[model samples]
Target: MEYFALTNAWLIPLMPAIAFVLIGLFFKRWSALSACIAVFASAVSFILAIFAAIAVIGSGISVDAPFVGHVIWAEAADLHFEMGMLIDPLSVMMLFVVSLVSLLVQIYSIGYMRGDKSFGRFFAYISLFSASMLGLNISANFLQMYIFWELVGLCSYLLIGFYYQRIAAREAAKKAFITTRIGDFGLLIGILLLQTVFGTVDFLELRQLLPSYIASYGTGTLTIIGILLFIGPIGKSGQFPLHVWLPDAMEGPAPVSALIHAATMVVAGVYLVARAYFLFASVPALLEFIAWLGAFTAFFGASIAISQREIKRILAYSTISQLGYMMLALGVGSLTASLFHLFTHAFFKALLFLCAGAVMHAMNDEADIFKMGGLRKKIPIVFITMTIGVLAISGVPPFAGFFSKDEILSAALSVNTPIYIIAVITAFMTAFYMARLLFVVFFGEKTNMRLHHISCFMQIPLVLLAVLSLVSGLGGYIYDFGYWIRFGAPQPEHMDISIAVLSAVLPLLAFILAWNIYVRKKWSADCIAARMGVLYTISFHKYYIDEFYAVLCRFFIDGIGRVMYFIDIYIIGGIINVISGLVLFSSTLLGKIQTGQTQRYAAAFLCGVIILLLCGILYFNKISGITAGGGVL
Candidate 1:
């Protein structure tokens, strides 16, 4: 089983990779076949992942003694690099999540994306997306992981901009790509620093050597490295100040959103931090900073989500908020809680996004929640499933989100009081926004929008994910999630009665508030907005964060661009002109001297000879003194 885990695990990524190539090559004309190939690849990967996970579990592999195998990829003087596979508790868990979700997304896409012009290409891109993340999850070293990381970004770029015909889609893809690259730059610096100082990027080897880096270089070095590494997550996970691209990412198809937000691109950041928890844990100050940053991002995202009218955009901001929640757990030094949230969030978020996709399908991609009304009886399944998703995300009792979100809150309160307060506030805002979205979209005044039939392909994944959302967190708790998916030390059973009650009660209160405002019209939303004034306006405009970024771009990026342009057109160009003028002027004088005649050349030579002879006779003889010797002359 161990050997099978090692040898056969590579197939998990390879299958989807091959599907990408095959669909791009031979299946372009057949959309159905293309989807079939992609889904089959992902299904095989899922099955293989299950078997591999079983092997790891049955073999009793622990974190400290994770099953790892490597073949030397390259060698140089005093250095060795290896192509490696690591089967640890974390990787195995990610394997199951990624493959399962990827498979379902592809299946869902068959119906959602049917009859689209670029359907084959869409499947191919998503296939590569899955393959890249699968590869990233099992990577044994930072080098391999980084390679897959960039691939994941590339897939997101392609998938997010799937409809290249739309200006918004194209720009969103570019924005998502470039924004993440900024964070990736910092992550690359951290990796290089680790390699330069420790001479290795292998996770296990680095784990053994990090203490020496501290002993020799002090905690300051780890602080820099940890922060640098975390910058990548901040960008990937849509944390504040770098989070403007996420809501815009709704330009793509619904399945793309589900795939990217729930299981792939965004999750990469939190997963990286969890995978490299040792570096962060070694630096207490960095961890604290991370916790605070996460707290603010959560608040920021949820605040924006409350005001968003677009179905997918609201979900997009919610994803950012949930990612912030995960990062908060990590920042608070509870990897188990963070990962547990990650696990549960995967299902519910995907379910939510897929349900939104269903609504879009039924309404011809109409995004405004205000335009959607009386959908409860129109699409009963989506309404019910989306309600479950909303409740799960709101941390309502017995839902997957309640268990995992409670754990994160518990983790935060035990560590920092201020952070805990921010987190609680964020949680309330989360519930309010989600409930508001529900009431506004499904139960508001009926609109004139036409509805289409949602196919079984889309509904199946929603049902499955909704089930996961309902029970995954409880299952994680029952199975002792902390025992395997943890860092520093094994986590003990923990649930503060007060915190749990707050977690449960606050969301319900927010739900009731949303009900009164949007459902029963007991409270006036516009009046509340009028009362809040600037605060409401700021949130409605997404806190003007994107505008702020645009301002910064105008001031700095565009400023630098103008400088470079001036140099190119004037400074550098003027110098070149000056040199050219000099060369031309000199050539013109020489051209005049040439005259194109032998007689003129002879006359000039004679004049030059006479002048030299006179100078020689006068100056040369005087300098020679007594004798005007020919030799002296």
Candidate 2:
């Protein structure tokens, strides 16, 4: 098992990849077969991923040295490009999470997407998505990682626009694609710079040589590279400024959302930062910036979620906020904490999104929480599962979120108080908004609509995810997950009891406050919003960030596109048109002269000769007249 796990890590990604091709090429005509292929392929991949994790544990894979396998793919002059796999604690963790979540989501999709005309195609796209992310997990070098990264991005565009008939889906796909490319461009440059300086982009090589490179080149150049690299994550992970596309990505199917928000696409960004911690660690100032920026994003996302109406959109904002916390963990120099949260987040978040799907399924696709109430009895399984997800995400005790979230706060508190303060505030806001969502949607007056059935296929993944969400936090104690995925030498492992208690208490208090306002009606939610008018309004509108980008696009992106279009249609085109017109005129005159007869050609040649003879006679007369005036002439 260990040997197979180590040697056949490539097969982990290959399973879903083969499924993708099969479904797209052959199985697409049969929706049931396509769904089965996708789910079975994902299940196999998940099984292999579990074995990979076991191999990591049994073999004692460490951070400093990871298993590397490679083969040269291209040669240019003195350079060689290789494709390979790198398996270690980090990759294995990501592999397990990516596969598990993808498998569950695919299974849940079987029910949620039933009877849709494009059902087979949806499975195909997500299969490709899973393949891309799994490939990204085991990438051996920067080149390989970036290739899979862009592939993941492409799959996102395809899946997000799966409902191509809808304007929202189409626009959202384009927005996500274009926005992330802005960061990807920077990342490309950074990778190129690394290759130029170090002569290779291999992870193991870089790890071995970074210390010497830092000493030789100074921190400034490394800092620039670090920032450029982080730009990719910032855009990918739904961090501020470039974060607008994340919430809008909810325009995709619910299963796609679960896959992306939970384990695959958005996590790619956080994973990248964690993967390349050595570079960031070398630059303290930049590291501090990351911590602060992450804290801000956490706050930003939570603030927006508070006033969101759509259940999926609320969860979307929650994804953003949670991603921010992962970034915060990365920034605070705890790779373990960051990845710990990442692991736990995959289970609970996927559960939450799937529950949202079940609820929407019941409500005939109405997503507004205001339109739903007293649904706990109607869909007991969904309500129960959703409640577990909420508790886990809200950082309540003994759930997945609490343990990981505590580590993030403790890490922050030990380093920077200001960021920690911001983190603590964000935690309360996260708890409040998530609790607000739960209470509002499941309580209040019951809403009536045409009910859609929730199938067994859908219920199973939700229940399993709820179980994981309940117990995944305990991995911190049972398995000591932190000790294995640590960046370097393990830090003294001790929980800050005070920090843990505070993080736990704050969330409970926030939950209580939400219950008061939304459940008991003891506090006026509307009155509070009215008092905080602009603040509430701003957050409700996602801080007008999307609108801000729209203005910039109109004045900048669209403006440039317009100019380019003008040049293509008029300036360059006019020159060609003028030349064509001149040729046409010449051809018309030539057509008149060059008749298809020897007589016409002979006549034209004779006329040209007679005109030349007349010019010669006139010139001779003019010369004779001048010579008559002077004998020397």
Candidate 3:
């Protein structure tokens, strides 16, 4: 029975990979069945993950499967790589969240992706992504974890560019892969350095080894390594400076937006930081830097999300901002709170994305909030689910997001007062923008260019995710799961009633303001832009961050790549050709002497032997430094 538990964890991830492989290999024959199989496999995996999480919680980390199955993956001096499963409280929770959201997204995709030619490919990629993420969660060591991490990134790239024919989608995918690759490079170096310093890569062993290792390296080396490792979180988590790819990622399908952008791929960074908490704790300066980076990202992302008219773009920025909150939690040394926020954010964010998908489906794939209005009545389930998600994300009471978000804010406050203040402002901005999006899209008079209806499959996931958004937080309180496990027990941590009230009040106020401006007063954003002038220009242009990145990339990566390409084609190739020609000429000269004449060959051999004997005698006699004649003779 215990073995069944171990087998189930591996099998849950394996089934999806199997489905993806089969669908990809036999696309023509298995295209139609792939969607159903993908959905079924994800659902089964989600159920298994839930059961596993419960069983792990019940048993309370009694069985640590250090390596359920281990195989030598690589070997070098002082470095050995093995692959296996590592089931801990953290991984169990992540597995459940990822699987659950994946299942719902896949189910929704059935209706949303219908009639699309690449439907099978879409589901296949989703299944592959789910399996990879689960594998990453349960990986036993850094090497295996890196493998799966890269796999998930690959899947994200594929899904983000699912519409490969679209230029914007292709560009976005390229940007995402390239940007994350830079982070991955840093992570790879950090892992190698850890392995070089500590002789073992196992998580438990490394946790024990790192303290002594840090003592030896001193503070400076530790901080450098910590900061280097933190680069990975910046890229994957959409932190400041490396966050340009996430917004463009909205070019993918809406279901993809729900799964990769909202639920799974983006959260992997926070998980990595939490996984390496022991190492991070040693470097307080690094942690503070991370905290400030997260704070700035949270504030910046929310500000950009506020002015976006495209529905998916708004959600994209929201995901970035929410990810910043999670990073902030980790930065504040509140790993449990960060993980809690991740759990709650997954549900509501997925719900919001799915509801947005439903709206897009209903409006004939229209995603502009400016063009959509009065959709609340047309898509009642979507409206209800979206409202739940919006409120939850806004940190309204009793919702999943409120508890986790409040915990993060409290943790930030405990760490630094200024960061806490910044976080609250970000929270207020989050509430305002979300409410603005909700009002402009769901309220007002009908302005849709086309009309359609959402299918039951799409609506069902929306409703289910909405329920999760509303109720998931209670799990931490009732079952003693999630953050409660780390906190030991749920105790009020000096709640600031004024800050909480301000956080809660601002969203409603934003909603009311948006209603007056966009709904009741019928003021268009463009009209406001005309009145505000430069403020509108800055908001509309997203403060020129994208343009800045473009200029930087063009001057560095593209320019350097072009020079390298030219060198490779002309100078390097010419050198190789010249070397090849000389080798050929030498070969030809040597071959001419290998004629089938025994007399000629014998003459040449005798001459060569004479020359060798003469040279050896001369060198021994003339170049000798010792008195060989007196000592040996």
**TM-score of each predicted structure versus truth:** 0.95, 0.93, 0.87
lDDT of 2 by residue, 1-633 (tens): 787888999999999999999999998989999999999999999999898889888987777667879999899999899999899989998999899999999999999999999998999999999999999999888999999999999999999999999999999999999999999998999999999988888888888899997878788988899999999999899998888889889899888889989999999999998888888988988888888888889988888998999999999989888998898888888888899999999999999999998898899888999888988888899999999999999989889899889889989888889888998999999899889888988886787766788999999999999999999987664678777888888654467899989978998999999999999999899999999999989988888888887798789989999999999989999999999999999999978866689997898899999999999999999899889877865
- lDDT per residue, candidate 1, 386-481, as tens digits? 999999999998999999999999999889999999999999999999999888888999877789899999888989998999999889888888
lDDT of each: 0.90, 0.90, 0.82
Model 1 scores a C-alpha lDDT of 0.90
Please state every model's RMSD to the true fold in angstroms.
2.7, 2.9, 5.5
Candidate 2 lDDT for residue 149 = 97
Residue 482, model 2: lDDT of: 70
Q: Is candidate 1 or candidate 2 better by TM-score?
A: 1
Collision pairs in model 1: none
TM-score, cand. 1: 0.95
Query: 333 in model 3: Cα distance from truth in Å?
Result: 1.3
User: What's model 3's lDDT at 292?
Assistant: 84
Model 3 scores a C-alpha lDDT of 0.82
